[model samples]
Target: MRGFSLLDSSGLPVAKTCFDPANIPEALHLDVWRQASRCGAQVDSLQRDWRFRGRTSNWYTDGVVFSHTLCDATHYQRTPRHIRRGDSDCLVLKLQLAGHQQGIFGDFDHFSSPPGTLVLQDWAIPYNITTTPYEVMAVSIPRYLLRGSHLMYRRNPVITWQPDSPQARLLVPILTQTLKSLATASAGEADAYAAGITGLLDGLLLGDRELLQSKYRERDRLEDMRQYLSRHLSDPDLGADHLCRQFHCSRATVYRLFQREGGIATFILRQRLQRCMQEISRMGVVQKGFLEALAHTWGFSSRANLARHFKAYYGITPQQAVEAARSHQNEGQREMNAPYWRDAYRVSRWLESIAPGASPTEPAGAHGGARQGPRELAGH
Candidate 1:
């Protein structure tokens, strides 16, 4: 409790050390890769001030207390490959001890926090954060701990509440003490403690039944907005006013929900661009018709307007994206055919070994003698 120490999942104590980038060895990249892998994301250090100190008190629960000065870095959660490989569905609660950070989640709303702010992040969605040099006490809560929270439906993945509030004022100290005391708790004991911990969190988050109901309503409205946008991506008339009329919500309420993603218009434009990119990547621009017509279908005024916004958003023109998609598809095809090509070569070698006169390119029924060659090769 006096100095930085770590307890493994098995309750073994570990010494702590500082990882300073200035003095890092060549293997530092691999170490960073492994750390990111364990944290269930891909990490890129954008700033040179990379200094991290961490201690995993419970590996079984992925609980840790870490402090770092990892400036200008982003962690990606829902990339296709990352999802295919699978991710540990967990929630991270970060108690900022010093400095501040900004996080983007839930349809691109950006939230910023200073010291004494508790931030919640879900591991299943795509979000990014840029932090100033800061110290934080981070606790990892297993997905099961967040059961009944209906986290998936909650559009605001990064929720920040300041510890200065009366409830947080009492809850923060209790949580800190509980975590420190349970640092050595056994696996079974940890599970028991986690229930109590989750109870505290439920109290902190819900506060009262009315507040819980409000959150549910907000979540439903967010989902409704997303659904409406998807269904009417081609409707140029769709905008903040249309959303307010459709959902029967006030303009203010709609704006607040989408503030992090710019405004309602920006959100719609972003979605349209995203949809266009997906279609272009799959069918290519050729199948999607003229860029101007494609733009009209997705609500853009003209091809030039679409091209201007698309380049601004993605840093590339629609034509470039099509080329990239083609390249990616080609690479995928090559990978898929590599094994088949190797097997064919092996089969040809076997046929030649069995019957010298046999042609590798010939079909199995090309010759009576060659037909027997496969049987002889199978025997060998």
Candidate 2:
């Protein structure tokens, strides 16, 4: 279509760190948050230029992250850092459009992901990514939505390639075409179309297994990797090599899976940090010795590394995260959290509900207790 445009207008753009770059490296900090209020979710994004790696990344920050990417010939890897620390159990689904993609989420691996590959991967921990030619479509949906949202395991990648399947071939292309058309429709129609694509993908991943099992091998492998990550967190050599061995895949294969995601070592450290974060949230901020030992026991080697990684992952140090947790419990961080979690529509509903006339108590002369015995109740 001519002059296709699909930019969200509720917020501004920013070139900021991915997490809190003061705590991370400059390269990894290549991110900026932009306000977006298009979808029903409290939407926003943190985008970055990936020319060095020859790529572009637009990480949606709110409801399922919807990313549209483009690039020339380039080597790209996106190892996302957690903007909020702690144990977050969510699923992510990546739909490819133009180029090939490869990813290693946990123990599962995708060597060459071509168009129509719906990669249902886990985001509870860290993973490495590589995208080629460089255009890809991705949407990150929370696992809770898939318990029944649309049948497409919103929490997993339903990547498939079955040459014999006509239905999958026909519909996947239609969905992609519709999404592209969304770019050219009336702004309102575009938004609706975008919304519809999200619905279609959600269903595909969570439902329609008759057409989803072509890549069942990858799905089973993913389950294995998730098990390995949690079960072997204590093993110091539990990263790339170990993962490669467990998957019975080559080292080169492993590297491609992780790409530049700080390599396998970084993934291991991040997972350990994530566990500590969960403990911090559950057991409170008091430095329990076992918890401190737990850090070293998991390969942190020292508390400093533990603290540093924690801050980088969550944008706040352990202590700060704990404090933020407490404050969040008290509805204090709503000042920041509300802006990120509640989309325009939800916020509007909130504003309308609590706007000047909002009240919890009943109105005067309402049905609930209208003078329990008004003159009509004289018989009482």
Maximum-lDDT candidate = 1
Residue 353 local lDDT, model 2: 21
Question: How many clashes does the backbone of model 1 have?
Answer: 2
lDDT, candidate 1, 216-239, per-residue tens: 666577778867876887988888
**What Cα-based lDDT does every candidate model obtain?**
0.51, 0.41
TM-score, cand. 1 vs. native: 0.51
Stretches off by above 4 angstroms in model 2 are 1-151, 154-214, 244-249, 256-262, 285-291, 329-380
- The most accurate candidate by TM-score is 1
* Local lDDT at 305 for model 1: 89
Write the residue-wise lDDT of candidate 2 on 1-380 in tens digits: 11212455223221111122233223321211111211111111111222212233323222223445454222222223331221222344456667665544433333345676655554443444433444655544443333323233223323444424543564456545644453344443443444554555555544666544545765455456656766888876577677777889888766654553456666566567656654554453455465457567776766777777765654446665455334322321223333222232232222122111111121211222211111110111
